[model samples]
Target: MTTSPPEPGLHEGEFHGGDLDAARRRFPNAPAPWIDLSTGINPHAYPVPDLDTSLWGRLPQASDERALAEAACKRYGAARPDMLVAAPGTQTLIQLLPRLLPQGDVAVLSPTYSEHARAWRREGHTVREVSDLDEIGTAKALVIVNPNNPTGRVLPVERLRALAADLEARDGVLVVDEAFIDAMEGSASLVPQLPPSAIVLRSFGKMYGLPGLRLGFAVARPEIAARLRDNLGPWAVPVPALQVGAAALNDDAWLQRTRVTLEESGDRLERLLKGCGCEIVGRTPLFCLIAHDDAGTLALALGEAGLYVRQFPEHPRWLRFGLPGEEAAWGRLEKVLRPQGQ
Candidate 1:
């Protein structure tokens, strides 16, 4: 495991969806159209409820947070009131965790989110990788991304609970970033378990396709949650985000339909990628990590043909593909894979 964190700062053409904003600006007239396969956001977004600006124009009030918290608990079956803390996005909560924990060493599961290690190291903590929980030792904190980003490796819930226990024994915090769990069949969300030293981060941006709204939440013991709230300050969630986010979370029929669509689309993507001679590593309900020695080149080729896939700079050999929304997208992608000299 690399004791030092990987290079920080965005690299050129690194395909996280948010990069599209810059891509569009740079390539005002790229030959082919751009299709974003970078971010693991659901292509189909939930229907945003009619916005009542008056209800949300001001900064989020305490009553508003309480209402949203209740909705989340009811939706995710959070058993306790102290378990959830809403944030502007899960990214914000994640960046804050290391700062909130007592000064000590930090261990992050590698080939995971770069931000986890980056955030810890940025705070002057020694960040290391843990392939398994045992490697965490008596560190100040252990961070794991359930259905880990890019890799899409979903750690079994039992293993996670055990790992949390190990960290707890050392009086350390266990932070589980469950950004993709909502797309899973049975999520291993720690939302219901608000253990004193455990924190779980959930993102509404990914599944709900409301990244523009910037909404997410943290689940921790009330005391920890209170500290996070105090540190992060009041009005963390804006009124528009709170109003629309609450409405979106309450839509059961939409949730069911979206889940079905994601499963089917994910299956199609996996099959298509396999047929293309790419090595499939692991996958969740949302995306899959694939490896080819020439992933960067292949991504460029796909981009030239109008598909924009994500490439991790550290692992140039691996790429992450978001589910293509329509068969036409896959058809075009497949067409690019045919033998050139045939």
Candidate 2:
């Protein structure tokens, strides 16, 4: 294999995580069955129920889609099930939101998800990457990733509520992406307290460990949700997605148990990384961010060793690792991080 530098995080859109196909191609000579620690997706996934043979042949019924919406509303503590709309994934919603809203200046609190800014810009809006809320200025729309991705920095609900109020005055919208909030402790979702001019997006895949299913939702005022529904047309969410998403959302025992498990796993990861001579910079339950002066070289080494982790181009010193699910996965990571002789 060539000893060139790696670009593991970039998919067609921009830099994010869990692109194993890109990883495998980048490190062609790395061993088979690479351990992906790129995204903040929960390693412990929700158990999917058995599907009927008929589900595949028949188109999803409107009622089944409604059931999924209700399950999501209850699961997220949304104001009303009618206020929710199911899409293929938050990526779809992320791209769709900018098109529906009046095109103008959009302020995204960054070093967060890159997709949010890119989506608005693609729709002909001036997008600004602001460091803090004070820099938002007169933007018509604001996007925030709650319990943020790599940094795991979370804003209080009150602060967010006040921001929503400020945007509402401008007839603007606040788009809060709560993709990682399921595993995030101490912070509450904005869905229940969803403001009049605010739109909250939820990712079922990240929390459920089934990003492949591509199910997600948007919680908003009834009119805004209706607008999204109209644009998306019929059958935006398929039958299997409806059935599986509803089942997963309603599983209380699994949800409660997983929350506890993720917290414990997060602490375990902290201990593991620290023991391996890495400094833990930030973390949510599903992933941890590390700061190393030589993160680029380290990332290249990890890539060569059949481990795919997220390395940000903008912040060259930062590296992000997702939780490894199984015991063997953890051992593989440890083996690579702490070689036998060391």
Top lDDT prediction, candidate number? 2
Candidate 2 CA-lDDT value: 0.85
- Clashes within 3 Å, all models in order: 0, 0
The 0-to-1 C-alpha lDDT of every candidate, in the order given, reads 0.75, 0.85
Model 2 spans > 4 angstroms off: 1-5, 8-15, 339-342
lDDT of 1 by residue, 98-215 (tens): 7876678888987787788878877778888777766776687888898798788777767777777777888888888989998876657766655566788888989987788889
TM-score of 2: 0.95
| Runs with alpha carbons beyond 4 Å of true place in candidate 1 | 1-17, 21-33, 326-328, 338-342
Q: Which residue pairs in candidate 2 have backbone atoms (N, alpha carbon, C) closer than 3 angstroms, thus clashing?
A: none
The Cα error of candidate 1 at residue 66, in Å, is: 1.9
